[model samples]
Target chain A: MQSARADAAARLADMGLPGRRDEYWRWTNPAPFMAEAVPEAGAFRADTPIFADMPKVRLVFTDGVFDAAASDDPRLAGVEIARLADAPQWAGAFYGSLEASGQAPVRRPFAALNTARASDGVMLRVTGRAARPVHISYRQSSDTSEAILHHCVKLEEGAELTLLETGTAAARANLVLEVDVGAGARFHHIRPQGRSHGHRVYSAIFARISAGALFKSFTLSMNGRLTRNEAMIEIVGDNALAHIAGAALGDGADGDFHHDDTVFITHGAEGGESRQVFKKVLRHGATGIFQGKILVQPGAQKTDGYQISQALMLDDLCQFLAKPELEIYADDVKCSHGSTTGAIDETALFYLRSRGVPREEAVSLLVLSFLADAIAEIDDEAIAAEILARLQDWLARHRG
Target chain B: MLEIKNLHVKLQEEEKVILKGVNLHVGAGQVHAIMGPNGSGKSTLSYVLSGREGYEVTAGSATLLGQDLLALDPEERAAAGLFLAFQYPVEIPGVGNMVFLRTALNAQRKARNEPEVSAGEFLKLVREKAKTLKIDAEMLKRPVNVGFSGGEKKRNEILQMAVLEPRMCVLDETDSGLDVDAMKLVADGVNALRDAGRSFLVITHYQRLLDHIAPDVVHIMADGRIIRTGGPDLALEVEKNGYADLLAGVL
Candidate 1:
């Protein structure tokens, strides 16, 4: 255990902190993260839990530390949970390992920082179909606290699991999640970020899929001061599918809010399908960024890939930046990518208003319609409806 | 029921004037057909009346039941019992047709201090109205006008008019993209909505639609003005001899 911590500390020192010179960090500066000091504990009261209406097994994490007394029993049929502190030897294959492996072709220094600094995390293994979703609710009682969490999930052959995540862990948080789906297994992930404007978050997901496996994830981000979410997915076996989608909204007149989504997907096996859909709604000088890439390796025949990133800017003061790239080495693959940024359609707005819909309600409908494509990516209808409700609430609060 | 006095309109972003001192009136239950050549400001009158953007009503007063139509927002104007069937029905990709209709109906009802219609009641009402317009169940479930045929789009507009049940309706080139059969279907839908408490201003470039709609009066529009007003015979004359003779006589 001591040796592993030493190695992680050494790696952290060697990598240091990312800077503006880094190609990936050019659009998002990491100075705030590097200079932030640990915050003191304070009172925090959340208005409502994101998935309160859904049926699930809940796990609570407070102030970056697991709260066993407040959380439900971590025992369920066909599933095993291990606290990282209890078995340090098992950390080699799950912790920092997957994060390190994802560095190939591109480097993510923040994920490494999480590995070196994370004090506690969850290790989950699914041997059979889970009875219900497993939800992890993060709570923060500090005004300026920081949390670094690492979670690893593994699914056995033919097993299925749904994971739901919500809440803001702290004022500033860094999270790294590694997932491994076995042959014929299916995994679904739905997360709605905390609706607090004081948060600055950096999160990463590293996923690997085997033959005939399916992996789908959708994230909804409503409020934050600054947030950057990075995802790297690799399809390692034939006939596998993976989809990653996100919808974000940022509205403020001060220009202090910014959100970014950077994704890299690789098709390493034949007959693999992958899709990426991201949408952003920015108003009142808010900014949004999207940098996505799809790589089809050599000999990856019959691979299907699609990527689209769009932004609806409510006013001229707001901004949207997108960089979509597709690299296909195979000859017989179908791959496409597109990015667009525009304001609400005046013609559609006028059409709705002429039909007796009020101007404000008409705008809200148009905004939701703009985001409908990305929201439709969620396979679970119940969870999709919950997310839709959250989106509507956010629109109602932030609408002009 | 509807009256216009010296209605002058121009493009908001350009200096080109589209309607110059246009005047017209229609009595209760009367169907007035405005026939003219292309760019004769027939559509402009409808747009200006509906409070569409990009048009500056430099001078005019339009009234429905003696209410000031120009002093209200588009939605407010709609709630005041005015409806405009678009020349080109917009294709909203994500909003369902049923949802749009129900929302519009309830919005108008709510603005008039009436209780909103429940889902069951609204669905039943829409189904009954849609049947008369030949709009099947599938069309009502799909997004508004998305991937719909030209005839289907026109029928959808009439369905909206029927559901809203406005006091004054304007049909702007509704017969432009319809075949003979589709035209008859649309005309039938409009004729079904005619009553003593309602009126219609059917603007078109052809006299064929007036044949099915049976307009009580017809007016010839040229260069943004009403050049001639007569009975339904005027539409026949224009259709038979073309607008060249009338336009030459007006100019």
Candidate 2:
């Protein structure tokens, strides 16, 4: 194991940061983060936390370090929280195992690097249904700050949890989250990346599900200099279900902003189901990319999988690139994937205008419609509505 | 309430002329029907009046209630009491029908410096108008025009017309995709909204719609020109003898 770690560190050092030549990094060049000196983070004051109204246990992280004095009590009913350095034996077992297992068939050097340098993150274990959600908020304090956070989560049998994450961590951030869902357990994740234009974020989620486990994740990415979010999910037990969805918006004019969503789901057990839905709205020379795939193993009969990635480009200068793939080794499995990129439907726009809707409002309506499908994937209505309001604000400010 | 003089229009992308030297006038409280064969520019005339894009008006003057309709944007024209019922209503998958109607009503009201309608008031108004058109609450709750049948689409358009209550309404082939029952339902909806303060321009390829709507005046349009103007009898004459004889006589 020590030799493997050394090998991984050496490989990451040799590869340095991902470049345009990397297959998955072709559309998004990671050269900005590869510089020897990280850029200064502009000072920002977040108006309010995303789920300020929601009754949740809050954990605050400042400059990649846990801020215990500013957070809720570590003790809560049916839930256990521990800082990575002081986590229990059971929690430490899952800290890096799942993430390491995910680096197969495809190499994510950023994730590997994140594991090597992660300073601090939370370890959460749900023994039973959590009475309230767990909210993690990140706050940056330094201009040239760099944050590496790796979170490990484990849900015992029949346990349920909802995790809400928000805020910008730093000027440059590398995040890895690993989850283990036991039999008959359910896990819900909702993350609204702060609308900060100066941050460069590379994040990944590695999740594994057992029999009859349910896992759903929804991510909303607003404006950022460069953001690449990767998710890898494995349904390892029969009758397990997993769904991953994202909605992103990029409205930068100088061509310095880009957002990418890359996801892979594997069905290794019978009767497993998985779904991936991603939508992006780009304008003013901003770029968006989606690369998603579903794999059904040989014995994974009765596997049901679906994947769709679509983009609504608000102008000709904006670009959207998508690659959807499905691989089935079982004869009785059902799998499908589709990708589409288009402008706002002109006919719909004309209809709205003819009905007395102004051009700007009409465009806003169309943009919301384009994102409705992905937003619907969020399980919590209140959270979904909040995210929707944030998206509307973004649209209003970036209207052409 | 609507007037056009020597209207000449051409496709924006192509050099072909659509409406050439056409003149027509519709009086207040009057229902005028324009009958023509395919490729005769009936739809083009309606589009031009509603301020649709992709058309260049080379020579024309159009007025709605003494306002220069051509100078206004589509939404402005709508706010200025002009409405066009599309032959094919657009389907917006996420915008609710009720939301769309309320937004439109409030938008026009705001443009005219009138107070915006309250949600309760708007709902009551929509329910009342939709009841006349047989549009149920369920249909109103669905996305605009999505999954609606052809008959339902036409009725929705009429419901919109009733809710908007514009001074000048243009119907472009509203009868094309309707059965006898649906056509009568639509006609009834249109008739209920008729008043001395409003006028209508109903464009159709056949005279069937005129029979139900009872136009006060009928005109024969061909080759991008209104060759003949007559009373309601002209519609019946063309309906029976067909445009073949009318074209022959004109030639």
Candidate 3:
């Protein structure tokens, strides 16, 4: 473990920090993250816990440091679990493995930095269906704390597991999650970051899926000063499925709010299906960016790839930027990509208002309707309900 | 139920006059038909009464049950019991028809300081109303007016009217794109909603629609003014001799 850490540190030193001159960081500036200093953010308060109704194994982290007193034992999850620092020999091959594979053709310097510096995280290996979900709660109570977390998960053949990451991590957070899905296994990830006004967040997910495996991930984010999310997925075996979705609402009424999602998906085997759906509602000078690509290598036949990113701007002050790319080396594949930025339909608004809905309420309905496509990707009914409620709550307080 | 006095309006962008000193009155329990040619300001009147934007009411007053209608927003006017069945119903892509109806009904109820209808009650009410218009369950679950045919859209407008139960309703060319069977079905739906306290302003280009809706009074509008007003016979004369001849007689 220590040897892998030293290798990652040396690799980070060679690559250095990201800058605005880089193609990936042009739309979103990297100045706030390049220095050795951690930026300041206001602390957040929540009235209720997310996913409060579900049975789960909970791990609590306050300002990047794990709190044993506030968390449930990982053994209660009915899965093999250990702290990342104290992980057994099985974790050595999977810790930085997928993240290193994702570095080629693209370099996420922050992810490498996280691998080198993260002090504490969780390692879970699921051999059978887990009795309960593993919920990682990043609860923050500090205004200037910086957190670096590196978590890894491995699912054995015919295994099933669900992992959830929620709450505001810290004033500044760099998180990296590496996952390996064995044959005939399934993995689900649902993360809804808590809103903090001045926070800066950078997170990445790297996964390798085997044949006959299923992987689904959804994220919901609303309030943050700056956020960048990157996802790199590889379907190395036939008959695998991968779905990634995100919904973000940017409110720049205060000062600055920008969110970016950059995704890359590769198909290496036949009969693989992948989809990417991302939607954002921006208002009052906020900005949203999307850079997504799908790659089908030789002999990867019968691959179905779909990507859509749309932004509904409430006013003229907001803007959206997108770059959608599709690369194919096989002739027997179907792939489509689309991106659009538009304002609320005036005619539709008048129709709603004429039917007795107030302007604010009508606007909220339309915004939610815009996000419905992305939210529909979640397969769990209970989880989708909780997300819908939070989305409604956001729209109510955002009415201006 | 609705009174318009010296209502003058113009296109906000072009500054061109559309409604020139239009005056009309619709009494409770009565059905009035306004017949006119294209660009005669017939549609503008409905839009102005419903408080749609881009129309400047330079002068005039529209009162609903003695309350000023022009002073309120469009939604407020709706809460005040005014409804307009659009000439071309707008299509909302992601809002289900059932959800839209319930939201509209509940919103009006809440605005009027009444208790909201529960989901079960709303569902029962909508199914009852939707069945009368020949709208099936699939149509109710689909997005509002999205992928619906022309006749389906018009019927959806009537379904909304029935559910909202407004006091004064304006049918703006609701018979424009309907076949005979669809027209009769829609006419029956409108007829079912008529009562002693509800009034209707039926604006159409042909008298054939009036034959089914059976207006008590008919008015001929030309160049943004009501040129003639009489009993139902006036619509027949206009339909027979055409608006050019009627304008000649009035001028």
Candidate 4:
């Protein structure tokens, strides 16, 4: 298994990188960035974040390897957290089972590469509800290295988990995450990937939710050179619900942000509800792309889904493109999708200004209002307040 | 404290002129009404005075106190102590009424270098004023004018004007879309706001509202021009016998 894993990594290295010619990689090319991708072993450097009040359990990753010494979070009682000397024990079963299902075959080359080279990824098997939320942080401190991987998380029936995953890299990195939600279980995944300076960041999340289960994931991407994020959630059981919200901020001259989200609610499932809201703020001539699709299989009765994606362009040079599609076969289901891309309302601005708020302050107020719905969804009041403060700070730093 | 001299304004998109060489002046301690039929340019006059964008002032000069009101932006004019109660107040969603009023008031104060009113003080004032106007306190907590009835929206407009306390106020067709009771309440609110230091230009199409508010002077407008000016009896005359007599006399 160890030799096979190493050989897979060697094959991944020989495959080099994905270019625009590939179907999924067509919009965002990662080849020019792959030439600069330098693999490295997990190591740590001393650094303190401004907000130390964040929950303490974190899985720290330097480059692509897992840091067993730095990440001493005892709360993470999952399958494995330490480094892998060889392929994981369930690797063959995990890959083979998913492929035989014939549901979303590994379409992207990067996903294939991640599965081949990823030996240090975490395997979190949640049997039941955990004590507290798990905070996972993957940091890349090196300037010339890439953090690449494939992560698999499985949750059994009646299990509940909250996972806070943040990816920060100085160079190039590609992080791939796969999650399986069991029946009557709950999974909350928060992916905040932004801090990739001059790096290419590509992340894909594939999830399946079972009966009487709830799976919700919020993606907040603010900083990246070339970023592409895709989240696919499949609802296969009755009375299952999935909620996904994403907020992305684009920065830098050549920075490109791309998001493709596909949520599927399979048949034989009744009373399934899904809601998604995607928002992007484009700045500095950066481009933001969002593609969201909701598919309801035949006989998926009583399915309720709502989707809205809005983009605010700060300047004329900045661009935003969005496509929200809905495919429903169930006649009794209620589904709606709306997409809008425009500048701020001038009338609202004048109304605020006439009331005497300065232009910048008025803009901030309007922007906050634009994000009011998203902020209101935070389940925890204290955490919601904390997130609002962080958002204000982020806005001040980026918008100002 | 408000003056409009030879205000000849035309609609930018068409051949119609709304206000033609109309001269009007209102000193403090006065309530003047311009009563006319539909298409008589009463609403256009208020909009022009408020400096709403897209109105071409072909030949006119409007001033507030001694400042050139036409030279300032709409917000700056608002800061300069000019206010217009719109015929159809624009609804702004997601902005609370109290927040909007306080922000507008404080903005005017800030422009004059005055300190902002504390939230507690503003809330107390709003509550008292709202009670007197028969406006529910819950209405003030909602988004401005959104989901509000016609009468409620008009009452809200008056509420804002009272809260702002502008030196010169223009109410454009405030009585058009109100029930009898709502009309009385709104007029009472306006009457309470009237003071020796403030002036009002009430624009309306009917004499019913004038009977309640009691404007000191009445002007009859026809074809974008003030064709006749008289005492309050002029409003009664037009109300008793529609615009037929007035149009006949003018023609």
TM-score of A-chain in each prediction?
0.95, 0.95, 0.98, 0.84
Q: Candidate 1, what DockQ?
A: 0.77
TM-score of each: 0.96, 0.95, 0.94, 0.81
Candidate 2 lDDT, A1-400, residue by residue in tens: 3343465576578656677888888888877766778776653464345788888999999888899898988777888988878877887556667767787777788888877778888899999999999988888888788888988889999999999888878888888898999999999999998746788889999999999999999999888889999999999999999999999988777336799999989999999989899999888888889999898989999999999999898889888888888888999998999999899888889889998999998999899889888888888889988998888787777775
Tens-digit lDDT track of model 4 for A269-380: 7788888887777767777776677788888899988888888877787777666777778799988888888887776665565444556766766776676556555555
Pairs with steric clashes in candidate 3: none
Please estimate how well model 4 matches the true structure, expressed as its whole-model Cα lDDT. Answer: 0.72
Worst 10 residues of 2 chain B by lDDT: B242-251
Descending-TM-score candidate ranking: 1, 2, 3, 4
Model 1, span B95-187: residue lDDT tens: 789988898999999999999999999999999999989899999999899999999999999999999999999999999989999999999
Docking class of 1: medium
Candidate 4 residue A193 C-alpha distance from true site, Å = 5.1
Could you arrange the candidates by DockQ from highest to lowest?
1, 2, 3, 4
lDDT of 3 by residue, A214-264 (tens): 999999988898999999999999999999999999899955889999999
Ranking of all candidate structures by their lDDT, best first: 3, 2, 1, 4
User: For candidate 2 chain A, which ten residues in a row score worst on lDDT?
Assistant: A1-10
lDDT of 2 by residue, B178-234 (tens): 999999999999999889999999999888888899999999999899989999999
Chain B superposition TM-score per model:
0.98, 0.99, 0.98, 0.96
Model 4 lDDT per residue over B1-251, tens place: 98889999888888777888888888887889887778878888887776666688999798889899878777788888878887777666656788778878787788889999999999999998899889998999888888999999999988887888888888889998899999999999999988899888999888999978988888888878788888899999988898888888885
Q: Which stretches of candidate 3 lie above 4 Å from their native place?
A: A76-78, B134-138, B234-242, B247-251
Candidate 3, DockQ score (0 to 1): 0.67
Q: What's the DockQ for every one of the candidates?
A: 0.77, 0.75, 0.67, 0.30
